[model samples]
Structure formats: structure tokens, C-alpha cells
Target: MNTETFINQNWHDANQQYLSAALAVVRGALESYTTSLPHPPELTAQAAARQQAVQQAAAAMPAPSALENLCRLFELSGFERDLLLLCAGMELNGDFARLCAIAQGDAQKAYPTLSLALAALAYPHWDAIAPNAALRRWRLIQVGEAHTLTLSPLRLDERILHYLVGIQYLDERLAGIIEPVPQLGELVPSHAALAQKVTAVWNQTKTTTLPIVQLCGNESSSKRAIASQICQIQKMHLWVMPAQVIPLLPSELDNLIRLWTRETILSKSALIIDCDELDINDAARLNAIAHFIERTNGYIFINSRERMRLPQRLLVSFDIQQPTAKEQSAVWQAALSDIAPQLNGQVKILVEQFNLSPATIHAACAEAAGQLAQSQNNNLTDILWDACRIQARPRLDELAQWIEPVANWEDLVLPETQKQILRDIAAHVRQRSTVYNTWGFAGKSARGLGISALFAGASGTGKTLAAEVLANQLRLDLYRIDLSSVVSKYIGETEKNLRRVFDAAEQGGVILLFDEADALFGKRSEVKDARDRYANIEVSYLLQRMESYPGLALLTTNLKSAIDTAFLRRIRFVVQFPFPDAAQRAEIWRRIFPPNTPIADLDVVKLARLNVAGGNIRNIALNAAFLAADAGEAVQMKHVLRAAQTEYSKLEKPLTEAEIGNWS
Candidate 1:
């Protein structure tokens, strides 16, 4: 047999012998106490010898027995130890019940109690049964319902009973609220360094209590990886309990604290209280968590998006960021190890475009591998990029409306200069990595790196269309966020909403279109009140997020002059969406109808005579199609004329005879 197996067998034998001997000693003591000739010297001598043999069996074990460890962990006194054994005896052995009834001199009292322990066991003390004593504090022994303290039926807790037999498991009471977080294999270098740093902090500290670690970051998985790594190094298990599950009732919370504290010792584990999704507005739950943190003793790590202010504790805060660009490149190479040679510069492009955690990167790679396996002729690089975009799509979906970009460059009826500017916006997004990273512009400073644009025009002047064109050109998802609605009147609420938006969009697979931003991004007035000052703060916060954002962010407004000059200066591109001239309107009319639609002698020149922008022209074309389809005929001049009248009515403008005189 192997050395480990040999030693385990010997320890099991020794433990069993020890338990058997201890049970015999208890049984003998109870019998001697209950006998009529109670003062038999030989019986007394035999019980004393059996107690010595119990001690010897325990000493012979290769490792400390479960009972010995339990006593040491709880600091159980000799009387407390004997009292616990008395309670355990009633469960483990059947004869102890009869002995207890005979000894108590009442057939009704068949169970062991504190009163019985005092009468039957050695070194008995009244304090052993006290509420604060080790026996009851650790819940090693539960006192059953009764009239008096001494007479209350004492029973070993089911969990503690299993524990005494060398069985190990999480407490059943806590099984629903907590779960184990296993260590992630092969952490990034930066994350591994963080793990080492945490270990040093825990090891090098000289304080009587270990400092609570607060890992602050937006990447929850990275923080968990670091926490799990630390536990692996220290040879301790890691468990996660969401902060929302903290009990609100005072008594239940107290019970949770005591029970978990005992569990940490028994299971050799540390807990990570996940507060990532906890709502800050919940006052009662927050207070419950604060109390839990302060009172629960053992190794603890707080996982949150931002640092939590935990007063009255030594909190060592570390901001856990996602893997750096270089680290990410290495991670990509490792995850795509088989195809690393095939991907020449694709890894660099992916690392620049997507700010992903290692876990997410691996997941994206797995998805790509699956697709590549299906089609061997597919371009590997494109498949990988598409997979990354799919993986990065989830966070932004919850915060904004996702608009699929269908308007390409041909569909947009904008001035040549404005179209070129839109193309420049797409170019910047495409080549940012080469210019920023390869040319060392990113090294100088990270400020103003995001490609931000301001599209200013009148309503229906193709501002949103231009955004959609850029989104199609760039092959990115376009999310239109109405800035007017997002701007909350409550102080700081606007900034909170904006922060959520920017943070969720940090993964660069989508373009953020903040439409109708005139009200929020307007000229900053003089700071006369607290509200005005906070309004300026909101603008500044948005400017900072835009400067650091890794993707394209476009803001549209009706009036250019309403935007603050300072805000305009920080933006990279400002495209003016001018109202379409007659020639441009004619072009919009020409391409507005799909090739599949039937047309009958459509006069683009006359349609262009109708005074409207590209947006209105497209609406008229669509409405004309529907009218023709319903009338069972091709789209003709009358259909176009009728649709133009409806569009003009919706615009609250008069359709003069001069503009549509040639339509019929």
C-alpha cells in the first residue's frame, strides 16, 4: 500500500479504538452511579483504567482525532468536553438511555441532561451549560426545551455529531446561502501578481487580526480569480455568499454570524461577500451587511464594483483592473494556442478593440473554434472578430436600444464634405490601434483617445442616418440613447446613469449614439446654485468618459450653437448634417425605393421639388409603396403626391402648388 493509504488506515483504526474506549468509560460511569451498591472500589478502579486507555488510544493516532480538534477549536474545558460526550453518548449508544433513567431515579427521564451530567460525570461545572459557554456558543450541544436549565434535555447537534466521527462537509444550515469558488487555472501575469500581493499583505501584517481585503473593480470575474488564487496559495477553500442574502432579522443574522464563524474553523475556508449587484438604495440590507462584516470573524474578501466604506475594520483596498494590453495579447495567444501561428496580427487587433477579461476571451475563443470546426473554408480572423463582438454585446443591450445599422454610404444623402467626415470617423475607429499603440500616441497619454463626434442639424436632416452609416461602415452595433431622457433632474442621478452607460460600453463592439444632447450638453451657464455646479460636474464626468472610451461615441443635437464650445473642442469630429438640396433630395428619391418594388414612370425631378429632407423623402417613398400595394397597382405619380401630402401634414407645413405643380 502507498504511504498515504497506510497512514490513513492506521489513523482510522486508532480513532475507532479511541471512540470505543471513551464510550465504554461513559457507560461504566453511568452504571456505577446507578447501582444499589454504589461504592464498589473495583468498578471505580476499572472505570479509571478505561479512561487512561481512552487517552492512550487518542495519543496513538497519527493525526489529531476529530474530537480532539473540536475541543481545541472551541476551547472546550474539561467539564464542557465531558458534558458534550454525555450528550453524544445518548445518540451514539442505546444503553446510555437506560443508564440515564436508572441513575436519575425516574423512568420518565430517559435522556441525558445537564442535571444528569452533573450527577454522573467527573469534573462537572454549572458554567459548562451556560449560554455563552463553548458547548452552547459553538452549538456543539443543543439544550432541549424544559422547565429548568439543569434539567433541560441536552442533545448533540446533528452537524457536530457527524463532525465528531471525522466526517467533513459544509454545514447543512448554510448550504443554501453559500457556494464554493474554485481557483481558476492559469491567471494572467498581472492577476497573478495581484494574487502574490494579496498573499504578502495577509502574511506580512503583524496585527492581531487579519485585515479584510476589498477588491474594487468592474470586472467581477477577475476579482474572483484573484481571491480564489489567494485561497489556493494559503491552502484554504473559498466560498461566495451574495450580500443580498444577509438576513434582515437581528436574531437570524446573529445566528448566521456564529454559525459561519464556526464553519470557517471547521472547514478551513474563507468567504467572499459578493456585493457587485447590490442596490445601493437598500438601507436595511446595507446595514445588515455592515453588521455581518464587523462581527463575523475569519478571512474575508469583499467583491464589489466600487470600494465599500466598512468602518471599524482594517480594510486593505485594491483596485482590480482587467488584464493589460500586453497581458491580453498573451492570453489570446494562449487561448488560441493551436491557431496562434495562423493569426498573424489579428491578436493585436482584437486586444486593441475589445477590453475583455481572460475568462471572456477564452469563452469567445471557444465559440470561434466551434464555428471554425464547422466550415474549414471560412476566414479564421473574421470568425474570431465576430465571436468577440458577440461576446461583448450583452452589457450594452440592457442600457440602450440596439439599432441594427442598414444605412450604408450609398443610402445617406449628405453633402460630400459631411460624408467624408463620417468616413474619417470610421477610419479612426479602424486604425486607432496602429496610430495609438504602434505610433506611441497611447503611451504619451490616454486622454482624448476615444473617437467622439457631434452631428448637428435640424430635425430629419439625417443626423441619425449619418450615425447609422458610420456604424455600418465600421461593422459595429449602434445603440441610440436619448440624452434628454437620460438627463435626470435629481442631483447626481444623471451622472450615475451616464456612468452605467460608459462602463457597460467599455468593451468596444458598439457605437454609443446620444441623440438630442442639446439640453444636457449645452453651454455652461454661470454657477449660481448647487444645481448648476452639479450640472457642470455632470458634463465634466461625461467628457472624461468620452475621452477614455475605447470605441466611437456620437452625440446629435438640433442646434450646433447650443453645444458648449469647451465640449465641442474636446470632440474629435463635428459633422454638420445640412438639409438636402434639390439635387441631393432627388438622389435620395432615386435610391429610396428597393429594387424589388414596382414603379410606373416615377419622376425624381418632380419628387425632389417637394421641400423635405432625406428622412421625410424616405417616409414618403415608404408610404407611397404601401399605398400602391393596397391599391393593387405600381407606385405612380398620384401615389407619390398623396404620400407627400400626408408627410407635409405631419410636418405641419403647407404643400405649395409651386413645389408639386409638375407631380401630376
Candidate 2:
């Protein structure tokens, strides 16, 4: 047998011997007290010999028995230990109840009680049954209701009874509140190193003064994996408790701390309090978390996006990140091992585009494999890319508006200079891995590597259109960041909101378009008041995050001069989407209607003379099509003229004779 099996068998044999010997003593006491007969001297000597034999056998076992472990862990005294055994005998051996009634000299008192233990058990003390003693404090035995403390009927707790017999499990009181973290496969090299470092920090310290190992980062899976790996190395169980579940009521919170502390001792376990999704603005919940951590002691890990402050204890933090690009590429190759030969260097493209954890990469590969199985001839590149995009979508959906990129380069009407800049933006995103990694740009410095652009023009110009075109060319998701939702009136709230957006977008296969940037990116005001200073701080924070962001961040503003000069200096590209002149407007009018739409007598040159931007021109053409359909005729000059009037009125401008003369 293995060591565990051997130890368990020895414990069982020793426990049976101990219980039998104790019961013989109880029977002897009953016989001498009830029958008015002399207790035999040899009987007493035989009980003592049996007790000594069981103690020697227990000492010879490889591991301590369950009863011994409990006594040692709880620091139970001699009286408390025997008192627990006396109550357990009533359940384990049915005859002990009748003997208890006989020994007490009353038929009604058939259960073990404090009064019976004081009179029957050897070396008993009155304080053994006190509320603060080991038996009552650790809840090893339950005392039933009675008129007096000494008369209360005592019974061994059901959990404790099972535990004494070598059966172990988590306490039922912690069933829903605490759950085990699932063990994952082998970690990447970097993450494995982190796990080792954490193990070293914990192993170097004593159990009572162990520092709280806080894993801080946006990659929650990596944090959890490291924690679980460390526990496995340390030979302990790891459970997760959400920060929100820390109770607000003091009584309930104290109960939870006591139960959890006891469980850690019993199961040799660690705890990971997950605070990754918690809102830092919630002061009440944060305070409760502090209280819970301060009260409980054991192997504790906190998973959060930022390091939490706790002044009362020592805390060590490790920033957990996703695997490196090379490691991720290796993971992708391994995940697609069956068909990796057919990829033709496409794995490199995946690693360069999407920053994913190993777990996510495996999931994406599995999903792609499922799709490839359903159809034999599907493009493997598209299938794999789509799977990755779907996996990274759920979190970003709650943060920004996902704009489907349908506009192509042919649709946008910018000048050649601005158009080239937009194309350059796409090229930067595509070749970033080559320039930064292979060419050693990343070795120099980490700053100014992000691809950020500024699109300054009027409202109706094609700034948003340019962002869509780039997203389409690059095959990435485009999200429009609504400034109203991001900016806050409260101090420091804007930075928190922005941090969440960037952190959620860290996977790097998406575009962030901040529309109407002048609102938040305006010039920093002079510090005449505290509000002014804080406002400047918010502006500086935005600039810092934008510069450090991995993916593309595009900002559009109507007033170029209104934006802070510092922001302009940090941006890599600035494309001016000036108001479309008549030539560009004519081009927009030419391609406004699809070939499927019926049209007649549409004078393009005359329509271009309306002196409006490309956006207004498209609006007029669409409205004209609607009017012609309603009148059951092809779109003509009269339809276009009427739509132009309506468009001009919406713009709050008058259509003079010079702009649309002789349209008919």
C-alpha cells in the first residue's frame, strides 16, 4: 500500500481500539455506581492497560490519527479530549446511553452532559464546558438546551464525528460561499516563473506572518492560473471567494471569517479573493474586504487590476500578464498541431495581431477546428481569425459602440495626401511586429511606439469615414468611444473610466475612435482653482494612456486649435479632412446611388454646385431617391432640387440663387 493508504488503515485500527477502551471504563463506572457492588481491581487495571496499548500503537503509526490531529490543532486539554470522546461514544456505541442513565442514578438522564462528565470522566474540570474552552470555541461538541449549564445534554458534532473517523470534506456552512479553482494545464514560461516567485515568498515566511500575495493585472486568467499553480506546488487546496460576497453585516462577516479560518486549517487550503471585476468606487464593499483580510489568516491571494492597500499586514504584489508573442505563437502551433503544416506561416500573423492568453488561444483553435470540420474547403486563415475575434468581443461590447466597417477606400472622398496618411496608419498596424520586434525598435525604448492619429475637420467631413476605412482594410473591429459616457464630473472618475476601456481593449485586434475629441482634449486651463488643476490632470492622463496603448487610437475634432498642443506633439499622424470642394462633392454625387437604383435626368455637375460637404451630398441623394419612389417615377432634377432645399434647412442655411442656379 502507499503511504496514505497505510496511514489511513493504521488510524482506523487505533481509533477503534481507543473507543473500545474508553467505553470499558464508562461501563465499569456504571456497574460500580448502580449495582452497589465493588468495582473489580483487575477491571480497572485492564482498562488502564488497554488505554496504554492504544497510545503506543498510535505513536508508532506513520501519521497521526484524525482524533490526534484535531486535539493538536485545537490545543485541547486532557479533560476536553476525554469529554469529546465520551460524547462520541454515545453515538458510536448505542449501549453507552443506557450506561449513562444507570451511572447518573436517573432513568431520564440518558445522554452525556456536563454534570455526568464532571462526575464520571477522570481528571475532569468545571471549566472544560465553559463557552471559551476548546470544546465550545471550536464547535467540536454541541451542548443542547437545559435549565443549568452543567445539566445541558452534550453531543459530538456530526461533522466532527465523521472527521474523527478519517472522513474529511469542506464544512457545509461554506458550501456556496467558497469554490475550488479548476486546475489548468502547464503554464507558459513567464507565468511559471511568477508562480515560483510567489511560492518562494510564501515559503520563506512563517504561517502566522505570511504576506498576502496580491496578483495585479488586467489578465485575470493568468493571475488565477499562477495562484492555482503555486498552491499545487505547496500541496494545498485553493478556493475562490468573490469580493462582493464579503458580508456587510458585522455578525455575518465575523461568522464567515471564523468558519473560513477553521476550514483552511482542516483542509490545508489557500484562498483567492477575486476583486478583478469589483468597482473601486464602492467604499463600503472595499472596507468590508479590508476587515475580512485583517481578521482571517492563512495562505491568501487577491486577484485585482490594481494593488490594494492594507496598512495592517504585509502585502507582496506581482503583475500578471499574458504570455509573450513567441510563447503565444508556440501555443498556437501546438493547439493546431494536427494541421499546422497547412497554415503556411499564418501562425505568425495570429500572434502579431491578437494578444491572447494560452487558454483563449486553445479555445479559439478548438472553435476554428470545429468550423473547419463542417466544411472541407473553407479558407483556414479567415476561419481562425473570425474565431479569435468572437472570443475577444464579449467584454468590449459593454464598453464602446461596435461599428461594422463597411466603407472601403473607394467610398471615402479625401484628398490624396490625407488618403495616403490613412493608408500609412493601416500599414503601421500591419507591420508593427516587424518594426518593433524583428528590427529591434522595442529594445530601445517603450515610449512613442503606439500608432495614434488626429483627424481634424468640420462635423460633416469624412473623419469617421476614414476610421471605418482603416478598420475595413486592417480586418479589425472599430469602436466609437462616446465621450459623454467616459467623462465624469467627479474628480478622478474620468481616468478610472478610461483605464477600464483601454484595459478591456488590451487584446489589440480593435480600433478605438474618440469622436469630438475637443471636449476632453481641449487646452489645459491655468490653475486658478483646484478644479482647473484636476481638469489638467485628466487631460494628461488621457495623453499618457493613448501614447502607451498597443492598438490604434483615432481622435476626431472640428477645431484643430482647440485641442491641447501636448496631445498634438504625441500623435504620430495628423490628417486634415478639410471641407470637400466642388470636385470632391461631384465625385461623391457620382457614386451616391447604387447601380440598382433607378435614376433619370440627374445633373451631377449642377448637384455638385450646391457648395456642401460629402455627407450632405449623400443625404440629398438618398432623400431624392425616396421622393421619386413615392411619386412612382425615376429620380430627376425636380426631386434633387426639392431634397436640396430640405437638406439646407436642416443645416440652418439658406440656398442662395448662385449655388443652385438653373438646376432645372
Candidate 3:
């Protein structure tokens, strides 16, 4: 039999033996009391024989019973232990009620009570009924309503009763707020090392007081798995509670801490306070968590993305990184054991693209396997790739605007030199892993490994479209960050917002396009006041994050001169998108209309003479098409002239005869 089954069986046998002995003692007490009118020798002899049989059976047991363990763990005295058994007997044995009534000489007081335990059982003490007694302190046995402590109806806690019977489960009252964490089967090397550290620390600490462990990481699943693995090593169950659930009021916090600490000791369990989703800036919530950590005891862990400060207690923090690329490749191969040979070289690409944790990798593979089974011709690599993207998509969507890349290189009308630069950026991104890891460049220097670019040009010069083109070419998601929204007015808030953006985007390695970059990356002013100093700090912070970011960060600015020169020097590429000359404008006009649009006798040469940018030309073509649709006619030179006039009017520029000359 398995060890668990064997141990449980032994416990069961011992519990039965102990219960039999206790029942014999109760029978002896009842019979002796019933024949109290006169000294009956026969009944007295029977009582003495039963008492001796009970003591001999107790001594003859192979091991201490679960009841004995419970009493020892909770430090319950003989009186308190018997009181607990008396309450348990009411539930386990129906005849115990009659025995109790006979012992008490009152039918109404048939149920177990403090008064009856003191009157009938051996070694009964008044202190056992006190508020701080083992019976009341740990809530082992609950007392029901009565005029006094002695008269109150006594009953065993459902959880403790089950424990004595060798049944293990969480208490019903705690079921809603806390959940048992499943032990992890396998861990990545980094996480396994972390788990080992946690185990070592826990073992080295004195049993009376253990330091609170803080698991700091961005991946919640990995943190939880590590915590669970550590608990497994210590032969303890794991439970998780969201940090947000910690009570704010002092009284409620105290009660919760006390109850959880007691439960931890009683059940040999550890707690993981999950603060991954909590807003750490909230003072009240932080205070509540601090209070809980200060007051609680036993094995506890706080899971958060960043380290938390707890002044009242000693804490040890473990920084958990996502599985390394090599580890991830191994995980992918293991997860795809059936198809690993088929995907001989594609596994590396998946690992490079998505920085998924081991658990996520396994889950994604399982999901992909299901999809693969549904269709014979479906590509397993594609399904897995899409699943990884989907897993990494949700967290970042809330922080930035997800732009679907519908525009390819052809859609972006830039200079040939600029186009080549964009391609080089894409190439750098595609081969970064090979160059850094395989070529040993990463070992040389860790700084500026991230691909950052500056798209400096006038407004509407295809900067954003260039980003979309790169995203399409790389097959990666693109997010457009509004600098105004990210750059907070308050101190340090800007860095916090940027940290969130970068951290969320780390997994997918998605391309980040910071639009209107000049708003946040303006030239640093002389430090004349606190505001100017903070502005410089914000700029420096952005530069640091961009340099260290694992993915590409594209910054677009309409005014190139407004950006700091120091910032420009750090960028790997600066693609200047100049205004479209007359020839380029004509080309834009030629391809501006979709094939489906009806057209008639459009003068492209004359339209190009308007001296507008490509964006304005496209706008004129669209306006002319709408005008033709309303007039029920194909777009002609006349419609183009009218739209150009309206566009120039909006810009407050004169519709000069030299520009639109001979259009009609």
C-alpha cells in the first residue's frame, strides 16, 4: 500500500482502540453512579474491572492515536482532552446521551456539558472552561448557549472531530476565503533553486518563529508553484489568499490573523498571500497586509510583482525570473514530445517569441494538442504560436491600445533608405537571440541590447504606418502608447506607468510605438526648480527603460529638434521621414484609390502639383471619391480640384493658381 494509505489505516486502528477504551471508562463512571444508593459489591467490582481493562487497552496500543496527537499538538491537559472526547462522543455514539443522563441524574442534561465533565470524568478542572484554556483558545470545542460556563452545551468543532477520526480536510468556515494549492509536479531550474532556498530558510529558522517569505516576481503562476513546492518539501499543505481580502479594520484584521495562525498550526498548512493583482499604492490595503504579517505566525508567503516592506517582521525575498530561454526550449520540447521531431527547428522560434513560464508552456501545449487533434491538416506550430500570443495579449491590452497590423511595407510610402532601415530593424529583432546567445555578444555587454528607433519627421509622414509594417513583417503585435496618457503630472507616477507598460509587454516581446514622443522626451531644461528636475528624471527613466526593454520601442516625433540630443545618441536607428516631393506625391496619388473605386479621367500629374504631403493627397482622393459617389458619377479632375480646395482651406493656405493651375 502507499504510505498515505498505510498511515491512515494505522491511525484508524489506533483511533478505534482509543475510542473503545474511553467508552469503557464512561461506562464505568455511569454504572458506579447508578448504584450509589448503597454500596453494591457486584456493580462496584464490575466498574473496577472495566477501568482496569480501559487502562490496559490504552497501554497496549501500537502507537498514539490521532486523538492523542491532537491533544499533544494543542497542549490540551487531561481534563481538556476528556472534555473534547465527551463532546465527540455525543456525535459518534447515540448511547452516550443516555450514559450522560444516568451520570448526571437529570434527563434534560443528557448532552455533554462543562458541569457534567467536572462531576463525572477524572481530573476535571475549572480552568479548562476558562476563555484562554486549550478547549476555548484554539476553538477545539465550541460551547453553546447557557446561563453559565458549566451549564453550556459542549460540542466538538467539526474540523477537530474529523481530525481525531483521521479525516483531513479544510474547515468549512475557511473554505470560501482560502483554497488549497496543488503541488507542482516539475519546476524549471531557476524556480527549483528558489524553492530550495525557501526550504533551506524555513528549516534553518527556529520552530517557534519563522521568517515571513516574500516571493517577488511578475509571473503569479510561477510564484504560486514555487511556494507550493516549498510547502511540499516541508510536508505541509498550501493555501492561497488574495491580499485584497485582508480586512481593513483593526479588529477584523486581528481576528482574521489569529484564526488563520491557529488554523495553520492545527492543519500543518502554509499560506500564500497573493498580491499579484493588488494595487500596491493603496495605503489602506498596504496597512491591512502589514498588520496581518505582523500579527500572524507560522509558514507564510507574500506573492507580489515587487518586494514589499514589512517593518514589524523579518522577511526574505526571492526574485523569480521567467524560465530562461534554454529552459523554455526544453519545456517546449517536453510538452510536445509527440510532435517534437516533426517541429525540428520551430521550437526555438516559439521560445524566442514568447517568454512563457513552464506552467504556461505546458498549458499552451495542452491547448494546442487539443486543437491539433480536431483537424488533420492544421499546423501544430501555428496553433501553439497563436496560443502563446493569446496568453500574452490580455495583460497588455489594458495598458496600451492594441493596433492590428493590416498595413504591410507596400502600404507605407517612405524613402528607399528609410525602407531599408526599417527592414534592418526587423532583421535585428528576428536574429537577436542568435546574435546575443549564440554569438556571445550578450556576455560582452548587457546594456543597449534592446532595439530602439527614432522616427523623426513632420506630422502624417507615415511614422505610425512604418511601425505597423515592421509589426506585420515580424508577425508581432503592435501597441500604440499615447505619451500624454502615460506621462503623469504627479511625481514618480510617470515611471510607475511606464514600468507597468514595459512589464506587461515583456512576455510577448510586442513592439511598442510611443506616439507623439516629444511630449515626454523633450529636451531637458536647466534644473531651476523641482518641476524641471522631475521632468529631467522622467526623461532619464524613459531612456533607461527603453534601453533595457527586451522588445523594440519605436518613438515618433513631429519635431525632431525638440528631442534631446543625448536621447538621440542612444537610439539604434533614426529614420527621418521627410515630406513627399512632387514625384513621391504623384506616386501616392496613383496608389491612393482602391481597385474597386470608380474613377474617370483623373489627372495625376496636376493633382501632384498641389505640393501636399502623402497624407493630404490620400485625404483629397478619399474626399473626391465620396463626392463622386454622391453625384452618381466617377471621380474626375473637377472633383479632385474641389477636394483640394477644401483641404487647403482647412489648412488656411491659399488655393494658389500656380498649384491647381490647368486642373480643369
Candidate 4:
């Protein structure tokens, strides 16, 4: 209820009782200091009585019961437990003068002497008198042998150190504080549960050490958060792997590890290897690090993308994903609790669109609230979009594609043969994953086996539209890979950029449309010099990647002749997007607008006479609708004719008398 009450309950009576008794003895010692001491108290019986009285005064108070528990649990020597109690109690002891004398200890000799502690009423081991002695493991009790022996008050730790410290003069303030190290989420649920299981296993087997718990996930924050939770649950001090904070140089990490190991063993804490950076590329390195984490009672947690294989010699591992939707809902609710009015629907949207880790959810929610304060809004949807964008922004920018799919294959009016070929290409792309691997198409290697299609038609023969239709059908993200970004003037940079795109998108399994392929996929000029040879090399590399890629890759070139014949030979599909005929133009007009658009009986037959391609047909209809809407009139035949006139002017083509006949 109150800080004092909490402190008293957590600290217990050991430290208090130890301090009181110690002070009482020291008080008696100073009173008797002018008399017979440990020497011959028999001859001077009165002086002997005074010395004995002080000893008896200290002995009258018993050690705190907590000390007995620590000794029993840790199997500590009776002397060490008593030594801790004496240290705790002596703090409150009114014997500063006598204790100071003991510390000065005939110091014509070593002033910072451990003998004072040993010489007190209790028996102490000479070996344990050293500063680094294992006897001081109860981290609360810090004794330093510097210019003079100094006793630091004990500090409480949630870690194993606290358990060992018991009721000594542990600092209450110290125990309550956390260093506030940054964390993602607490230990993932499965990891915490697994840790409990491991602890039980350790108990059953009496194993003295713990192995790293390897987890796989997209974000490292969740892994680290899970790890921190584990240490808290186990009452262990948690530290993220020191390698992160240490420099990258060879010896730097090693030195950090040494410092880390010493501090952990001294503090009796565990380590969590938050390997959020683990991926296919770093599998070997992940395994190597996990190898080293297996040697300590200080546990290590490895969170990675996939299962890593390491010698099972003493290691134990479990996998964890970001919490389920239900769990995420709870996390969202908890994180957004402060802004419930604003977050009511925004949380749901985030849950639907993003599979975020608990840490990410909290961060996003907090950020959303902060932004809302700046924007002065009670609604959180705006903040939600910002968070979503931040999460999605890491996937590199090839060109972003927009797919407004209003028409399907049936709406397209290509020639019968071209239509059939287009349908076949769609089918091939649809069944690619199953057919390619099952049919042993990608068996020889991942090299040069992807499905590459070339769309060779006039500028607007539905090439881009077809790419969108297929992408929508496959339910995959479509990226129009900017060739300018992919092609490099520098030697070999072209291939390097291409590899980055392919490698990053390997998991997303996106469809890449390399628009205007003629710029790069040109006929190889004769090997006139090294530049020409490099140009040929670039073409060869593209061909291999297109074939080897395990996804659909489409290259659209307006001029098929510009693409090398050799490149065409390796392409699995090449569909020509022919110029639109009268019939095709009519079909494009019929489907140009949605049924909801208000039209004043515009005839698709009359509109088709303009002889524009599908792309231009859609553009003209859009312009015409805006013009009609602004005039507060329905879109009629006159609107279509005027839009067409403007569209033809832009194309640098004149509307023929036969095409525009009887338009008004």
C-alpha cells in the first residue's frame, strides 16, 4: 500500500535485527576497552568480566531467521551465513568507535584488514577474508580492500543474488530500481513457459547450468522482451547479449564477454541472446554464437527467423511466434488503454493488416498517441496509418504499383490466338509453385527456371492491365522494378542491385514487372571492347536470374524487335499486345465506366470509332466524366466526342472523317 510497507515486507527483519545486535555489542566493547581484553582476563578478573560482558551482549541477539533459510537453500557454511547476519546487524550497532578500532587493527599493520571481521565474537575462515572470496556472493554485501577495508551496504536484486542475500543489510532502494534498459517485449509466452519447464528439469537433474533458448520471429524486440520477462519471472537479472553493446572488432567482443561473464556470475544473473537479426544469411553465425551461450547457468535466449541447428550437447531450445490474434488484441488493448476513445477502431485495423510483435504494438500505440497530441485529434486512425507505414516501409522501393482491377480476362478483346496465349500465360503463373517444383522444372538448380513473360504490343495494348489482373488473382504484391535503379553504369553493380531485390523479396514472393525492358534487354553489341563485353554479361545475368527465380517475372517491351533474339529464346511466354481494332475499341468503351456513372445514353458503338487503345480509352472516359460532373450534366455523346478530341490531340493523331462520322 505504501512505500515503507512495501519496503518492510520485501526486505524482512533479518537486516534490521542483524544491525541492532551488532551495534549493541560494539557499544559494550567500547565501554570495556580501558580494561582486560582477550589477553589474560583471568588475572584482572574485573577487566575480563567487562570484555566477556560485551561478547555476551552481542551473543544475546540471534541471527535473523532469513539467514538460516539462505544457508539451508544454498547449503552455505554456517559461518558465512553468520558473517552475513553480523554485517547486516552491525550497521545499526551503536559500536562505531570499537568497530573503527578493529578496522584499524594494530595498523602499524594492514589497516584495511579482514581480521576485524574474523576477530569479532564469531569464527571466520582466513581464506574467506579476501575481497574476491566467494563468501561475498550475496551481492548485497560489498567489501572492498582498498587503502583500507570498506564495507558497502548490501543491495537487493531480483536476480539469484537477492535469493542469496536474504535479509542482510541489502539496500531497499537498490532492489526496487531497474536500470531501465530498453526492451522490445517481455520474454515471449512460450519462452517463459519453456523456461519454467527447464528450471524444473534442472531441479530434477540437479543440473548446474542452462542452455540458450532459440526462438524464431521477424522482430527482435519481441524476443528481447520475452527474454526480459523470463529473467523477471525467474527472479534473474536479465542482460541482452553484450556483443551488441561491445564494438565489432575481434578482441572487443571477447573482452566484453569476459566482463559480462564475470559480472553475471558475480551477480548470479542469466543472459538472453536476442537474435532478432537472424536470417537465412546468418544461420552459420547464429549457430556459432549459440555454441558459446551453452556454458552458463546464466540462461541465453536466441530468437531467430528459422530453426538453427547446433550440437545438442547441453543446449535446449524452443520456438516462439509473435502472439496470436487474441493475444495481440490483449496487447493492443493494454498498450492503447490510455487513449481508448481514439484507439477504438484503430487497434482492429492494425490487427487485421499487420502481424506485429507485442513490443511493436506497444511502440506503435505510444507513437500514435504522441502524434495525435501534435495533430490535436481524438481519433487514432491517422496515427494508425503512420504506424502501419513505418512497419511496411523497410521492404525496399522498387516502383510502387497500383492495381484497380475492374475488368478480367473476359473483358479483354485481343485476337483469338493472342487471347488463348494470354490465358495460357495466366494459367502457367497460377500453377507455377505446384507445377514447377512438382514437374522438376526448378530441380537442376534455382538458376534460370523462373517463369519470364514478354508483353510486346503497342504502348497501350493492356500490357500493364494484364500484369495487374494476374497479380490480383495470385494475391501477391506487385512491384514495378525500376530498371534505372537496377541497371548500373559501374561494372557489376547492375547484377548486385538485382540480387538485392530478388533476395529481399524471396519470402514475399512478389511479381516483378520490369517495365520498358527494351532499355536493358537489348541486343548485345559486338564485343568491340571491355564495355561491350560487360554489357553482354549484364544481359546474360538477367536471363539466368529470370530463369532461376522461383516466382513470376514479367518484362513488357513495346518493341519486341528491340529485345535480343537470344533473350526471347529463353522466355517462357511472349504475348503480343496488338493495336486495338474497331471491335476491340468497342469492347474497351463498353467496360470503361462503372454501372454507377450517370450517362445520358452514350453509344459504345459510336464511341469506339475513335481508334484509341485500352489505356487511352480509360483515360478519355475519366476526363469526360470530370468535365460532365463539373458542368452538372450527365455524360452524353457530346462529352465522349470532346474527350476523344482532346485524347487524340495528345496522342498527336487526327480523328479521321470516317472515325468521327455523325459523332454529334
Candidate 3, residue 336: how far the Cα is off, in Å: 1.8
**Candidate 2: stretches off by over 4 Å:** 1-62, 86-111, 153-155, 339-342, 593-612, 616-650, 654-664
User: Which candidate do you rate higher for TM-score, 1 or 3?
Assistant: 1
In the range 578-654, model 1's lDDT, one tens digit per residue, is: 88889988998999999999999999998889889888988999999999999999999999999999999999999
RMSD of 4: 11.1
RMSD of each: 2.5, 3.5, 3.2, 11.1
* TM-score for candidate 1: 0.93
Specify the poorest-scoring 10-residue window by lDDT in model 2.
Answer: 26-35
Alpha carbon deviation, residue 69, candidate 1 (Å): 0.8
* Each prediction's number of clashing residue pairs: 0, 0, 0, 21
Which pairs of residues clash in candidate 1, taking residues 3 or more apart in a chain or in different chains?
none
| Two-way TM-score contest, 2 vs 4, winner | 2
What tens-digit string does per-residue lDDT give for candidate 4 at 196-235? 7656543455556554566555556655666566566667
Quantify how close model 3 is to the true structure by its C-alpha RMSD in Å: 3.2
Write down the worst ten-residue block by lDDT for model 3: 27-36
Best by lDDT: 1
Q: Report the lDDT tens digits of candidate 3 across residue range 64-137.
A: 77777787888988778778878888888888888778777789888888888888778878999888877787
